[model samples]
Target chain A: MRKFFPFFAVLIVFSMLLAACGGSAPTEAAPAAGGEEAAPATQSGSTLQTVMDRGKVICGVNKAVPGFGFLQEDGSYAGFDIDFCKALAAAIFGDPEGRVEYRPLTAKERFTALQTGEIDVLIRNTTWTLTRDTELGANFVATTFYDGQGFIVRKDSGITKLEDLDGATICVGAGTTTELNLADVFAARGISYTPLVFEGADEATGAYEEGRCDSYTTDKSGLVARRVVMADPEAHVILDETISKEPLGPVVRHGDDQWFDIVQWTVYATFTAEEFGITSANVDEIKATTENPSIKKLLGLEGDMGQKLGLSNDWAYNIIKYVGNYAEIYDRNLGPDQPTYIPRGLNSLYTDGGLLYAPPVR
Target chain B: MQGTVPESQEKIPFWRNEHTLQWIAQFTVLAGVLFVFWLLYANMQRQLEMLNLPISFKFLQINASFDIGESLIEYSRSDTYLRAYLVGVLNTIRVAVLGIIFATILGVIVGVARLSNNWLVNKLAAGYIEILRNIPLLVLLIFWYTGFFLKLPDVKEAINVGGTYLSRRGIAFPWPLPTETYATYRWVLWLGVALAVALGYALYRQGKKTGRMPLYGLWSLLLFLVVAGIGIVVLQPYVMDYPHLPDKGFNIIGGKTFSPEFMALLSGLVIYTSAFIAEVVRAGIQSVSKGQVEAARALGLNGFQTLRLVVFPQALRVIVPPMTSQYLNLTKNSSLAVAIGYPDIVHVYGTIINQSGRAVEMTMIMMATYLTFSLSTSAFMNWYNQKIKLVER
Candidate 1:
């Protein structure tokens, strides 16, 4: 027995190591497998059923950008992107409040979080690019905001144009489309600049504020939002030059078509509601009295559109009632009264001479 | 007859056999570990396939389309991801190597000072070591970057000393630029170095044979200087490139520039690592027995002679092992360069992972790269340690 003690000790150590390795595997695999078995209403690859079983939509969002997905002082998430996540929650769970788990992700990890099912949907003010759309295995829904890459310099720096930025150190967020655009635009125009890339937007802006960099570059909307948080907002001026198109939108993993359709129509429902001049206050009255065929279809009164999306008939109504229409979402977050206000130019609906056009619900 | 036979000599069933049990346990554990790994691999593959992002290295061939702030080699956005990865590798190596060199020098000085009889010197060294070693390296790096380097004046109001300019952007100094004749002069320089080495080796051997030791290092340095002087006189190998503020630009053109990020990271690494290394050196020196020092003194050796000849050689045997770990720590800590925007391998790989949604491949590559770096460093250090080990009779 004494001689066998050492052998038993060795066996225990080996088993512990094996347990350490094997333990995490089942925990990871078990949840998905169990969720699949527990929810039989939908197919296996459906994110909708998984989200239903979980009872909350795990939304990947940015926590820094003001009026887009910023975290508030009261520990609640606010802004346009946050509202869209709420809209998604409302569409799925019939209630926007308490149905979302906001996972604040960095620009580098947002897609990975989506691909790995860590988040049900990513509404992180992420841009829709060909590379992101195709290679990242993410399906971009309707463009929520049309933006462009722009630079902001100190008002007194006398840097008015792209050519004037030659040989200047520019601060930018790492792993962002803004970083790639700055590189491409500078290379194209024969401008030489040093990019001090920070891991987060706050760090980049902080560096720029310290005058360590002559300028900071990002999405124009982001610049507008971040500018309000600067020490002296009036001291910095965004350049007039637009470097690249940034059509920001929500994203989801590509394999789940039903989930993709649900997210897409949820965004369109907001657009359709805005186009029809439906407000959250008047949505119930309009649903009761409206005779228009499209309005009836959009409000889920005349058709099985919500059922087609594996949702209740009142899903679109829930979205409007809780999260509001597109215009209301825009006005709530980036309206004239808001500090992060940017005049809605290209983000306005197509009928109002902008790029936002959602296909008809019928 | 059975009772007379020893209980130890009786045959045991295979099921009850301890040897068989041990083997079974070993095989079971091995199989379990392999099965776990296989399960993880299969799960990853299935998930990746479902997402239409198969694990492959083909992303390396794609254009990186991102610009790094500083690189040792010429790189543009048109460069491949592989080239960008190499740039990151080179940047990491540059900081680690420079950090090791500077840290060693500072550490040795501080370590010696810690043991000095001078009260102020000893206390100061102790204070430096205690304060620096207690703080987290990341915080120290951030402090050095934002508090010290970034606090410098902006480029327009740069502090100029002679032809050098110091600003928040960087410190640009006048450096020698290679001319056409530098190619030919380089070979002559190498030849001079080789001749100096040979001469130094021969003199060392002669000194070993004779009772009197010669100044081989000084002689070798003088001979090399003479050769270099002749070469300089015959061929002007380089021209001094002075940095000057362009009338219309924000940056000083010409000469070499060390970005504030690089300086901050290097200084942080050097200072933080030097503290730990100083303790190692102190411990190593203290490990040398007091009796050995007394013996050297009895042999009429001075303090300096006792240290140089008797103490350091013996102390090194104890020092080299811990010192190897310190060097590795510095190398790995260089990855923290990402925090301050130093564009090290980890930072570059992060950007790559974002640009191409190939996180798995990039992470694996990063793991393999760091492993290679650590293994090679340890291998070289082990060789040196072995070389310096006391020879057994």
Candidate 2:
């Protein structure tokens, strides 16, 4: 008891300090701006200012899926989603090589990482679903790629179509849209199949290769990428069927409207740049001499749209000059020219008979 | 000790007083811990509110919108996430229970074999323990699932056992089908089990008082079957479906099938855990005194009887405590099912967290589940330990 005197004194002081710090935390976060919206104002402000001050945006992405968010052999990320991360950085810092930190995450860890501020934006090949949109407290910026669930089977397996896959054992990544869609579509078709789920697409592919499953299922885009890595590419084929709509895109946490706007408009700028025939190479020339009001406004030659989103006037110009237009990003990663080619069917510009239509820049 | 404290020697200030300071120290430490916890709670609340993320368990009631590969209970995409979680819990418990039983049997056998007089048997048991103990469990799980299970013949050339089959898909066995009349049959079976238990207890009590060995095991078996036989005759029509080799599909048609994931996970858990349990059992058996065994042998008990009646009872006393921990380990280790997608509780909750983004609430539920499992296992083991403990006058 006599020896405990100093310990008690120290403990009392520690508790006092903890109480003082905890007591003031709530009030400390309360006085940013805007009465009812002050929380979001401070939340969004602090996040945006942090990125600006830190000079790097932490982006969560998938390292496994090729053409969307694959980490290349050169120790650099090279994919469509990687370009989106670069585009966001370019919007903020006016340099495509702006300090962007990439945190490769799995499907299980991605959202929680975003919610915890471990990543500022998630640009993985994530599908926008109702539950994710409404419940996950994450905001989908815009659809970058339109994909759908499809099956890849050995050509000799005689599984030519979805109907032919009845009673088949399919390997899929657990917790993915592919897994859920497979269940929904199979049940709807009144076909029974054994689902062998894996945590990662890599493992599922490994199992598929070993013949643990009759077929491997994932996004058609993913299937293409996975198929290219097969031992014999021509030996397997992706079925010509799309089972579920998978609108893949970039996602940011909710409550940061300003930051969300920065990411959202950054993606939209790519489409608008493409819509106006402005590629990365000619973005500077167009910004300098364009007379078109929409292009001029979009390139930030007119209007304070960037200012409204708490960015510099040349934010759109920076995005185009750095990350290129949407078509360039797509063609570089997933076009017919690439090994993992995916047709730009619904991902093309609206005028090209696709569903990708950006809201008017003005 | 009380008298050593000189009474009324000095009237010290409360802070300087020994007993007062000791109480103060404890209370201060507890308060400090509580304050730290409060700080974390406040910080989480602030972050959640700032992010506009509602913290609620209401999402558990919403439709899962996902399908599990295998379920023991009725489950569909329309079922609530809570139901899905329940299915996962049931699956986990099933595996844990099965793993525990199989591991115990194998552990005891290998443990006994480890000390066998036969040099070959001893070396073989030692080899098994050494090899399995050295490798990481996850590596083994992946190896078995891919190198062995996946390498099995394709479904078209499944290894046939009667009408059942084993292939890369999985193994299927004949299972009794539940029909509309199964409810009545189930009641009859329950009644039979209850009656058998009562009669067995009566026979044991009679034998105990009379100092004669009771054939309680045989009597219980005969009585159970008699009651069940009467019920079956009354019911007249019962149905059982045998698994049939599929003519040309990847799955069996009529009977219950164990998914490859389940088989891999179960085999991985059982084989891995038995190695550690085998060591514990070996130590327990070795801890028994040689004098006691010799005394039993001097009493004209045969070697087997000396082991069964003398050595085993003592060894059990030493074994039960460590065996409780092994049971808990097996239960906790079942979480590795996520790697192979066995749809255990962790895997299911993980999917829920990914889909719904209720990371905080879902994590809390997961922690609570494992905590409950460990606590219940320890509680049961503690009760059994107390019963088996030697009474000292």
Candidate 3:
């Protein structure tokens, strides 16, 4: 044993050095995109083909957001984002109830999960930003929702706007645009407020409720979702001010253009279907009798856009038939009548005086 | 089989020779490790190339665009990620140092209590060790911040004593505000302290040479405070500001305050780590022979004198080595501050990793930082161990 001691020690050191070199090569080299995303192509299979072969789409989503992607008590996921995932699954499998495996990810883990090919697409409430697109090695397909950061405080706190938050403590979720935006706006306005940051929305909101912080900051849509769950929703009120623009949408890995195009058009198809007045309930009727060329092409009656995307011509029809159009998705989860009661404001179609404009399907 | 009669005289093949086999085995293992490493490197390179994501540290120069909840140094959103990271390192070191000091004192006290003749004190110390030792550190931190601290009274109804206040928001205490004159008088204060310590050392050395007892420690402390008091009176380096509740009293201002996150993390780490350290101290004290204690008593040394001069000095030999490990554990365990948003190194890195997408680089830096801290702590303890080591006659 004495004779081999030195050899064993050397062996252990060598292994450790080897492991360190392997583990940190990417991390040290790329400080911005945590080493997790540094080697995306290291995985064995093409994500697009892998999903097809497995007969399921592995979608990264948020299970915490109320109107976007919430996990239900029955163990089923229900939200606008879930519907979009189902729509993508239907586009591939030609059935709205097609197999989709939902993976819930936190704000920090979403991009890395996509970069490492752990999920085919991330449809969490992710904002499209220049740095995220270029540096994160992930591609944003299209904007599905236009949001803005807002603050919520108990009515008795008397904080009605950004100015009123001066010298007050603001609670925000860490590793999010809301936190960054709060810093920007507060610093710009010369407000001397302390920020209490938490790792999750629940923690941030909890701190706010406990009076540890005077205000809770998040996207306006999220504030509404969080408010509805409060024991006494009437006591708290969301501020009228919008702090920062947040355009949230689905995201896919950067390398595969084909996969990117597929997800992008899946979002656009919903927009076009909504524009053409095609509902899931009325899609079959429109396909049978539509005379308008764009409507016909969108429903795969007059064009081969689906074929170009490596799918059958009936892909859009399947998405609409199974997951519904944009209107159907919105009205189902976040419409004014829902528990969240979020207005379509900027999310409405361009024809309806909103920011959503779909390029002609033809 | 045919060469059995002359095998001793025959030249052996390299593979059959024991000396050559050992070298061959060593080289083979080394080569295999190298090959596996090479494979991993090649795979990562290929993947990065395909993904069009080149590894570069240039992103550290970019604006951090995020704010830390607390920082020791000046920081703004406009600062680079590197600066933000430095601030994070400072915060981490601050907590680690404070935690180590507090944990050691608490650990030693409870350790002695565990061995006390009094039943209640012994049972209480043992119970503390068992309870803190069993629960997970992360759960403890969560419980401390959310379950306990958050349950404190609202900010408007803060419990105030003198000028300080305690509320769910945080604990506020009086703070000193230094003006322009502080810079000139600070040096005088430092000089006074140094002179006092040097004078104390001289007295200690003189007493050692002669047979006199000077009580150097007590005198030195008094001398230091006297010199500092003179400097304060002459220069007026700073003004003390008392914390108070404003009219609305929503939050405490114009004072030094410990953020709820920082308090929870520090308490959880100090409390949880003290339990393990208490066990080490107990074992160390027990290792001193019973004969030594009885011998000291027979020499007319009282119980306190026997403990301080005989038991503790000898017990330190065994304690220092393990105490080093406990200090390191407390420092490393501080990474759990990220879970509660305490803005420690790990928490800051998590935000940077998400913002900059440099997960690999942040992880490497974090590992290097912890390693440096552990080594530095071990080196200091080892030096102390050498000073107290048994010198053979």
* Best-performing candidate as measured by DockQ: 2
Distance from true location, Cα of A17 in model 3, Å: 18
Q: Per-residue CA lDDT of candidate 2, range B1-393, in tens?
A: 332566667766676666765676677688678878878887787678666676889989998878888899999888999999999999999999999999999999999999999999999999999999999989988877877777788777778888677887788777766667778988999999999999999999999999865768889999999988998778844666887765777666777788788899889989999998899999999999899988999989889878877898889999999999999999999998898879999989988898778888898999999999999999999999999888879
Chain A TM-score for candidate 1 is: 0.90
Worst 10 residues of 3 chain B by lDDT: B1-10
State the DockQ of every prediction: 0.54, 0.60, 0.40
Give the alpha carbon lDDT tens digit for every residue of B1-393 in model 3.
433547568787776766776787778777867777786767666555656666778889999988887899999889999999998899999999999999999998999999999999999999999999999999999999998878878878888888787888888888889977899888887887898889899999999899564778889889888988888888888898877777763577778988888889999999999999999999999999999999999999888888888899899999999999999989999999978878889888888888887776677788998899899999999999999988879
Judge candidate 1 at residue B273 and give its lDDT.
96
Local accuracy of candidate 3 as per-residue lDDT tens digits, A1-362 = 25875776687777777777676544423434445554343332256677889899999998888889998899899898999999999888888564899999888788778877789999988888898898888889999999999999999977777887777888888778888889999999998788777777777787888788889999898999989877789999999999899999999988777788788889999998888888999899989998998877888888797888877788999999999999999999998789987989889999889988877776
Query: Residues B1-393, candidate 1, lDDT per residue (tens digit)?
Result: 332446778686777776776787778767756775776787678667667789999989999999999999999999999999999999999999999999999999999899999999999999999999999999999999999889998777889999899988789999998999999999999989999999999999999999555779989999999999999889999899998778777777888999889999999999999999999999999999999999999999889889988899999999999999999999999999988989999999999999998999999999999999999999999999999999999
Q: Estimated TM-score per prediction?
A: 0.92, 0.90, 0.90
Q: Per-residue lDDT of A1-362 in model 1, one digit per residue for the tens?
A: 45756865776676667667656533433454546343222233367777888899999999999999999899999999999999999998887789999999988889889888799999998999999999988999878999999999999989899999988889998899999999988998899898888998988999999888889999999999999999999999999999899999999888667888899999999998999999899999999999999999988898998898889988889999998999999999999999999999998999999888889888
Q: Which pairs of residues have clashing backbones in candidate 2?
A: none
How does model 2 do on interface RMSD, in angstroms?
Answer: 2.2
lDDT (10s digit) by residue, model 2, range A79-135: 999999999998889886847999999888898899888999999999998878877
The weakest ten consecutive residues by lDDT in model 3 chain A span A36-45
Model 2, position A31, has a per-residue lDDT of 65
Instruction: Let me know the TM-score candidate 1 reaches against the reference structure.
Output: 0.92
After TM-score superposition, the amount by which residue B40's alpha carbon in candidate 1 deviates from its true location, in angstroms, is 1.5
Candidate 2 residue B134 Cα shift, in angstroms, is: 2.3
What's the best-to-worst order under TM-score?
1, 2, 3
Kindly provide the TM-score of model 3 when superposed on the true structure, using C-alpha atoms.
Answer: 0.90
Q: What is the lDDT of residue B340 in candidate 2?
A: 82
